[model samples]
Target: MTAAVRSTQQVFNLPDLGEGLTEAEIVAWRVAVGDVVEVDQPVVEVETAKAVVDVPCPYAGRVVALHGSPGELRPVGQPLITVAPLDDGADDAGRAGAGGADDPGGEPAGHAVYREEERAGSGNVLVGYGTGHGPAGRRRRRVGAARAGTGRRAAADDTAASTAALPEGHPTGTGAPVPTGAPAVVGDASAYRSRLDGELDAPLVISPLVRRLARERGIDLSAIRGSGPGGMIRRADLDARTGGPAGDGRGAGLAAVPDLRPAATAAATDAGADAGADEIVIPLRGVRKTIADKLSRSRREIPEVTIWVDVDATGLLATRAAINAAQPDRPVSLLALLARICVAGLRRYPQLNARVDGERGEIVQSGRIHLGIAAQTERGLLVPVLADVQRMDTGALSAALAETTAQARAGTLPPARLTGGTFTLNNYGVFGVDGSTPIINHPEAALLGIGRIVDKPWVVDGALAVRKVAEISLTFDHRVCDGGVAGGFLRFVADCVESPAVLIANV
Candidate 1:
């Protein structure tokens, strides 16, 4: 008679979400034990040092266990969930017994060992863990023939002996090797033979744990030349590829990773070496940490130079007034007008709308003007990208900016809305600041800062008169262009502010 096979549990570990982060606070869990999940379905929402990211489940199975609760910090490589692969309804004891003696575990010997190569996942891996590949092919299980005088202890003893015989450092538990001379356990031996032949035809990369480890270390697995049978990616091959163990010391040591800040700020971080009781230390994490890392990287990496020019904004203010007078109910913001001028300036000097690709050793100039507007929210400052600003008119641009700013302030802006910007327009003037240099948003080569347009004494047409004056500051990466390009872009914008007719002519 065929013996019923006990379901095997597969533990899914928390993957290092490609950000080089060690741990994340579990914000919420989307699944509970016993719930069946499909591949790529979001299993949890975790708050990393950079942002709140949704992590997806790689396995499609019945959830057997969940490891952490909400608000608990879980480290990379910790077991997150357990799953039991569903069985295919096939009963064939004769085929199972064909493999002969019981498995070293003392159970029906012919039960096929589940290979790790069969595991599947969705290819959509976020900063958090998801399967690096697509869905896996379906599999079947075989029931073994019952043996007399066999008990749980006997099976456990046999399993222990098999584990004891393995060489040191080899994977144990579910990864234990199949016994020698074991037949393929299945309903139809010929069908199983055909399937095995097909699988053997291709080189299989079978270790999810190894993949996760490689990802955490920023090691590209595909580039690694596998040494195992069928060119499989083994631990030894990965060791050679990475030149060390999987542990990059990200969880325990910060010194190993690249320093984000320059020496000055690094020294300043220790200014309060002896922190007083009155001092409140804020830990760098979440959005604040993300901002720090980005801004510091921008300051350290980009050779930025700022140039400012005070403009007679009498015409820009007059244009705004004329628009308001024409449409009293719908008021035009000064920032939107500034955005239009920026788009025009970028058209004349398209070199500023680019990023220095250090890896590729080239400058990628973007064709579209995806403008990022800086907004200060309750949580922190966030730049929500207003895509394709070159396509929008003053009315449309104004509406889009207002809506995006509202979303940013409400803390409901999606991650997608915060990225993919070609240029940034910062209206510090709204804060009533006269003139100040701003940090260039990383990746984007340039940022234009607009100061307050206030009534001031200005010499226009060689006459001293009270006119609306504003200051425009342009901060640009020197690698993309020199002072000639930056100065021209700023000067053109100043001209537009001084005379709106240039903008009208361009339009």
Candidate 2:
């Protein structure tokens, strides 16, 4: 019998870090080439559109190569790391007994084979393996024996060429159908040209952005010819059809496009067209880019209405001081007290806590309260969410808010903790501002802005007296509720601030 052929090298692709992100900047690498790593071990740290996250490697093997350097941007589904998998043909006993002397799942000493099943992943979605949404099939393909003067690269090239050269709907030589959802590789240009020439009736369009562009521009997607693999329509194809409109036009708004492509790439492409010695250009990247895209979208899509109310915060301030004096060790923050009042108000006006699902034409009213606390860190502004805020008491809410704030400052909050908020509480008072018409965080229908609590002259029992006062503003989505509901929510919150007894009774 001829010698057995073994499959080894496996390339891991950069997985989607969620929030429909398409690319990420590699922050740092945890492992170097020739270093052995275990499954679910973090191989790299990347900064996505939402947050900085650690990407785990799904395969347990010796790292062969890394694709990108630190601070370099890599597209989703691109090669992230290459691993040489353990040989699979070893004896069953050897594979089974390969457990470590110290632990059951630990690495075995000596030359025993490691079982693939033994190196199972963490099942978490952020493994640098596959798109988290799809069935995660391995990127393994069997190759034929190498010819003279050709190596593994040549074999892979030949396989791709043969696959591309096959007639439409034809199978590979092994009678196996083409893999569905497999990433398209560089194939024979002549074969692609021939297919493009013959098949121009309906273009293969996959990107949602391309479809949206066609819908908006009244351009027929079927009428356009695609230059991508398998006749896939590309952004360039649409740009060509649109004649690539100039300077703050229909196309300019799409430049800082999120989800589809990196905003930096578009910004760079635009800046490259007008590179001048006197120009000072800054790249739209990382936290700044994310903020820009989100704010721009919120401004464009949201019909926001801002309403402000002045309140006597004397009772609220007294309650906070009394609580701190009673339990100095477990003191509650003033902001947390305000948050409690906001939560109580939301219970009375649930419409303020709900989101308007415009696509579905429905108002999604949340049953449970998940509050987003906006904090400014060195990186930028980030909102860390506290789940089930209605369950937390004053002390617990204060502790949770403090922990999240510290985590944000330390840049250690997980991406999951930064999302899924039904409502938002913005404390702009820390900056000593009296009031601001802050933009409502997208998807969350309303945001409550808290101002500084200061001593001001107020009417107390129809007499002018100095009292603790504050200004509160509510920015709400008009589509979710009308001015009446918005005013009621603000009035209820102001009442709670004015009389802490109302808040305690509601609680």
**Per-model CA lDDT versus the true structure:** 0.65, 0.68
Q: Write the per-residue lDDT of candidate 2 for residues 174-275, one digit (tens) a residue.
A: 445444222222122222222322342434554434554566456798788777655567667766776653323666677655332243444344334433
Quote the positional error of residue 184 for candidate 1 in Å: 54
The model with the greatest TM-score is 2
Error of 2 at 205 (Å): 47
Error of 2 at 398 (Å): 2.2
What would the per-residue lDDT of candidate 1 be over residues 1-507, giving only the tens digit for each residue?
Answer: 233432345677887665467887775565544344566665666666644555666676555567887657899889887765544222223323543443221223444423233348755655223334222111112112222332111223333433433334444424566443211112222222232322323222344334445654566765776675335566556555644323433464543554434322432332223222244355566677788888999999899999999999889888999999999888888889999999999999999999999999999999999999988653466798999999999988999999889766644455667788999999887676899888889999999998888899988779999998888899999999999999999999999999999999988
Alpha carbon deviation, residue 99, candidate 2 (Å): 33
State every prediction's TM-score relative to the real structure: 0.52, 0.59
lDDT for 171 (candidate 1): 43
- RMSD of candidate 2 to true structure, Å: 18.3
